[model samples]
Target: MTFQPLEQALHEAIDWMLRLEHLPASDPAHLAFEHWHAHCAENRLAWQRVNGVLDSALANLQGLPGQAQVASRALRALANPPRRQLLGKGLALLLLGAGSVSVLNRLAPVADLLADARTATGERKTLQLADGSRLSLNARSAADIRFDTQQRRVVLRAGDLQVQVEPDLARPLIVATAHGEVRALGTRFMVRQESERCLVSVQQHSVLLSTADGSARRVEAGQAFAFDRRGSMAVAPSMRTRDDWVHGRIEARDEPLGELVEALRPYYGGLLRISPQAAQVRVFGTFLVDDIERTLASLGETLPIRVDTLGFWLTRIDVK
Candidate 1:
């Protein structure tokens, strides 16, 4: 299912809500909002959904003194031009609260919703394909499966995957990302799609890694490779710990703190921000992916860093 239209509708509904918040029923914008709400069924549904979330959030705040004033202040802050870029982030923190399913729905990528297989935040899923191959998806991951008489393909939309291929010379298994493809020559391997590159780790046998530019390299078992559309390079062997997420843990071998934070983001329900200096801090240890707070607390104890958490909505890490 494609969520593009619905996503657009939801965004428009939010815009309308913000606009109408300070406008009277007699305002010209009210007429425009009415037209937009009546434009289509999707608009109506999005409006209802957005209002439902806001109502729930308001109810949650009802116990506080001057609840109406608090909400009004938050909405007005969101309307500021300087803070416009933070509209989503601010709302997620101040109004939506933490771990709101509505927030997740708004933040999730359209491609993820349309994927043939996907896992939600902090969730892992395993699948046995029609060809007897086993596939494991990491947190916040998505992929599309395409199988035919000719080839077996899994397109990684985002995040990481580990697969144990069923031997079939007749139909080669290939994992593709925006950067390139990893053709499994043997069985077990892992693939991760990063912002600017794709990472491949071979666990059982060798796989042929190819870039979008037609460059190719053979990555042997126990080796890891990283590549973008332009070129490829060998990553540190220890980096193969990329698949460690499958075990609900991360084994950082003197890795940068930013890498560890990136790994933890998918598992975290709300915003997790780290300063550049803190991110550069070298980390070496094992951390649990499922328990973000505990892991972060452990890090804070061991590293020269400060961790500030605002309920469950946000956690900010900085160099101490």
Candidate 2:
């Protein structure tokens, strides 16, 4: 219950922050500040996370030379978000004055109630939901969840996921990604929606994939497909094995090294680059996701591939 409230506050705060940060320190925002502050103290605290995110965002922008002038000029992004302070006051009332931590808990689920969360840069997570279902997240994944009176929705503002869903008429979990939207109807399936292409592969049960333009496709279990601005296509049957990555494993059945690299990009941080000539190399079989060093080592030994490490984290794969 406590968890639910915190998450609700978090979701609300994030939306407000986006609105505030996108705007300048204008008159209407300033005039609205007082009521906003009166709203709650938790709002103020919640905004801190946005500020924290901004600090890092600014630091990154600062390093980009010409970007310094443009971003510094936009430092006001933080100033106007003072609107968040309103949420902080209300939160304080609920947590402190009301002294009903139990009341709030019973009333709301606290933060981090979502079934899954994954970090960026060499991170992964496997989550088991309340319904005896499973969801796995790749690197840099995020979702704001709402399992309300009717449907369960996972709003994928970013990231990729594979879900094993159990039957539940009360609530069916749906994942919305950038390129397309997918909903599981009591099934085990994989959904990979990057900025451009969205891939859906059903291992068992079934799924429905729909694009922004309302192009709909029913993906049955065992078959895999990918879609983009060009439109969706049934991924070659040879590339349909979707269960291989469950235990940090990648399986390629006579797949081009180029295609393999593209598939692996989201799993790795920085870059997983392949040269034009190197992309021509074909790779086969499964590799352990747990052991990047050993996996790359095995590739070097088994295939005409060279693993060139310029610096600690920089690795380039080339045809030997």
Best by TM-score: 1
Give a tens-digit lDDT track for model 2, residues 48-76.
Answer: 55445434444544444554444434223
Off by over 4 Å in 1: 1-51, 54-102, 105-108, 238-241
What candidate 2 gets wrong by more than 4 Å, as runs, is 1-116, 228-231, 237-241, 266-271
What's the TM-score of each model vs. the native? 0.69, 0.60
Best by lDDT: 1
- Cα deviation in Å at residue 114, candidate 1? 0.9
Query: Model 2: which ten-residue window has the lowest total lDDT?
Result: 103-112
lDDT tens digits by residue: candidate 1, 1-320: 24667766766776776668778788898888889999998899878877767556556544445544444343344324322323334343434335333453323332366578876556678999999999999877899999998889999998899999999998889999999999999679999988888899988988999998899999998889889999899988654436788888989999899988988887675678999999999999999976677899999999999999964457999999
Q: How many angstroms is residue 266 displaced in model 2 relative to the true structure, after the best TM-score fit?
A: 4.1
Give the range where candidate 1 is weakest over 10 consecutive residues by summed lDDT.
Answer: 78-87
Native RMSD of candidate 2 (Å): 17.4
